[model samples]
Target: MCGIVGAIAARNVVPILVDGLKRLEYRGYDSAGIAVHTGNAISRVRRVGRVAEMEAAAAAENLQGTLGIGHTRWATHGGVTEHNAHPHISFDKIAVVHNGIIENHEAQRQQLKALGYEFTSQTDTEVIAHLVHHYYQGGVSLFDAVKQATRQLSGAYAIGVIALDRPDELVCARMGCPLLVGLGEGEHFIASDVSAILSATRRVIFLEEGDIGLLTRDSVVLHDKNDQVIERAVHVSDVSLASLELGPYSHFMQKEIHEQPKALSDTIEAVLENGFAAGLFGARAAELLPQVEGVKILACGTSFYAGLTAKYWIESIAGISCDVEIASEYRYRDAFANPRHLVVTISQSGETLDTMEALKYAKELGHNMALSICNVRESAIPRASELVFYTRAGAEIGVASTKAFTTQLVGLFALAVTLGKLRGRVDAQAEHGYQEALRQLPGSVQHALNLEPQIKAWSDKFAAKQNALFLGRGLHYPIALEGALKLKEISYIHAEAYPAGELKHGPLALVDESMPVVVIAPNDALLEKVKSNMQEVRARGGELFVFADLDSHFSESDGVHVIRTPRHVGVLSAIVHTIPVQLLAYHVALARGTDVDKPRNLAKSVTVE
Candidate 1:
């Protein structure tokens, strides 16, 4: 994933571009660069590190301009270096910043080389600048040249272009990646995500696939692939600027973990008011539910775990069979679907490349009954889907997601209950009871968050371990997977999750005193079976960290530490039980001196395959 930002202003633009890049730093941080059109020429400054590095260079040189494009790269096609950084320029010095892979760059490079174009960097993005320069040399306008160049390129891309000749205008286009235009007074801005431009302007125009926009200081013009003019609608965002800050917390991850209580409460409040379900999903589900035969969920990383959890919720509550598949893998599979089948895609960033592609593929298959549960409004997932359920989690800056994941679970849970009521699977009394529990979830989640101190204390004991095992059954199995994933992602610990019953087959041999086994033992039908598996681990002298219900028979002992969670029923318990494991991973990583915000070789948004 990479972040792109551009601005045309009546005043100095370099500072604005750099500040935007700072807001977008979470999307990518490997390298940073900016290209500005000064009075006489295009000035380019780039460095192979954080945005601060490039900003230092810019300040040292006193670079000033009123039009510029900047980028923070995550290094997909080439190694992270100055040569591979963005704001890549052509021989004529025109610059471009891109946020997606150019899949057919090799062939384009070969053709350019045949035309005597010399290459300077090992990046697919460089080919775009050269291609634009190639067309510009033939007397095409900069806007037309960029449009023509895109016709020769293949694969996903969201590009912002600026040239010396067109010093007053910045051109942008998107194909299967996210790019947005921010509307302001006497100024216009473009960025890969809204967080970058929110301070300058809350009103935004989201660019669609195959759509192009030309930006000037005063106006923005939209056009389709054929260069035909199109009307653009402006959407004002409701996210407060304060939500992006970490406040008094030590880290973004810790702040986000603590924010879960409020996030969940907000989501529950939004979903459970009197007759809110009828107003929100009643008519929509009535129109779409009877036509749906099954569901296909497309997601990646933590959102994929939420999808897995939703599979249990939908099947058990609505009597609908659902399949959860990774978006990257789902795009390549020959899965069968029809107009009657619904596709549900989950993404926090909504710019996840594979998940976006999967949504595109489902649309191509004529599955119009599409629903997206996303946090960011006007994100690509919401743009590509037929219906959207926006998560109320404000802004999740931590690379290891906390509030976003829990809020997504809440959204999916609400959707499942709504669907169950619409399909007659839930009687009125049962629906009311479920709604009451849903209303109480926010307070329950706050109580769960209160258990963090206990979880942090437990994490102190296991921070030195090199490996840990997580086990659960039924709906909790996905919770186990998510817990293990969090530990591995942030703590750099080698962790694995298995169904408690599968322990004896292979995972049991790895158990010993040095190894820690974490079990999700909420009171359920499978609790006894999971308890037996815990006994097996104890027999082998394995240390245990169990998240169990207070009424359960499990108790704390010397070899075992028990974290008691409030009692919850059905799939809701899995949601409540996940908080402790998330806190454990957060605290463990904190204790181990790991970079919890930006883990090694990980990006917040996976925008490429």
Candidate 2:
């Protein structure tokens, strides 16, 4: 949930570190800091607020160096103050910047205290600084010192280290968090994310788990945990800097919301051209996917919701049983693994810590095959899986996901159709019809986007409300859940979702004129059942806001407001219905005057447990 960028270059690296942190600012942070080897001593500057404030301080100090590391902190183990910022130094010997949490930091701090080492900040990262500095004594080299120090740390970490005396080199290590070394001409770099260094270098070496890297002005070396030399492939990143630009939009969230149409087209174009097949997932998918008797999807947050939406499709269309689990909770529980079950993991960044751990645990329990639906191809989850489907929804900088979520749905629906065809559940005519719907999905999403003006009007009234209720029936309850999540995530509204049939069970007691109810009313078999539930809400004076299909024949009435969407695309209605709810959340947050891109207490990626 933090950002780390470092460079050992021929020219001054203070500007490089600052620029990298600015690019990484889309990942939410509360404090920014950087430490550089100034040829005399380590010059460290930290600020409690934005990256701009820290940049101003560096300019005032005239900070300059050839080697440096910078960090933007999200306050995991300490307060949001300047003293709690990163680039933590010890004995003026070494400065360290870290991304993940240290589970055993308290024990390490106490042991370091016994060695007469004084600590200043209340951060777990300070212990890392002291450990590296303490090991750099008695004729030990900087490379061996970092390697030995990392052997004792017991948690996820992606660290960048710079020593006062070693001004020409930088050291970095990765365990569970994502880290990479960027190779350049006459220079080298290290960063927790590739986006930080996209402007400087496109060639990158993504370090694997338990790998430590040593970077110098001219050479890059990598080693495994046993201190033996290792080799990893270097891949040029495909993310264009132009995609990172918010050209015409005020916020990245808004930009991503409007980009959903093109994003859907890019993600499903392969399905449109080649038709749905098991081979589309990967080379091994044809051999492994046909053997699948059950599916268990492991994901977190928005990806978990995507799995929930997929569950309805896989079961109904594919005629196969599917289960979705929250990856964080699945880690501590006992799972009954079956050899024929396909364990699927979904993540946008592909570096979600708990989901990766859960996949490992499933494999440990005798699950033989795994697949990943991810956006980043080189990320941990995709490499760890036997098969993968990459979503073409490029870099999602907004903390609240928009394009990434919808693209996951597209891949999931494709997977369901592929499985259905393989298991003899779907005939040729049905498969062709599904393919047509897949091709029309982009146009349908664009049709939903046309409701933005009406959604904005509803948001103006929703901004004054304190709570909201979202309702849906079969095949779309997950959409309602996602809608309620989006409302609470950005707009800061207390919201909840329930299957419309469950209204009388308990939630109906909260209904009043002050409460707003948002309904997902498409023209499906359950529409009449949902309408009866709407009548119950209207009887209790609860205002109703319905996103209905064009053919649903819904009309505005007392205490009821209807916004008609485009006609539903048969199997892709859930994805189309998702657009309006996302727009409502964005416009509502706009009406509330909140930060739409970086919401409070949330980061674009969850790299820690």
Q: What is the C-alpha lDDT of each candidate?
A: 0.87, 0.93
Clashing pairs in 2: none
TM-score of 2: 0.99
Q: Report the CA-based lDDT of candidate 2 relative to the real structure.
A: 0.93
Best by TM-score: 2
Best lDDT among the predictions, by candidate number: 2
Which regions of candidate 2 deviate over 4 angstroms? Answer: none
Ten-residue stretch with the least lDDT total in model 2: 137-146
> Per-residue lDDT for 134-205 in model 2, tens only?
999745978888888888899999999989889888999999999999999999999988999998999999
State in Å the error of residue 439, model 1: 1.4
Predicted candidate 1 versus true structure: per-residue lDDT over 1-609, tens digit per residue: 889899999989999999999988776479999999988899999998789999999999999999999999988888889989989899755799998889999999999999998888899999999999999889988888889999999998999999988888999999988888999999999988888888899999988879988899888899987778997788998878888887899888889888887888877776667432633533365577667777788999889999999999889998888889999998898878777777989999888888888888888877888888888887878877777788889988888888999999988887777777767888888888888877777667777888987888987887899999999999999999999999999999999999999988999999999999999998998889988999999999999999988778777897888988887555588778878888999999999999888888888888777
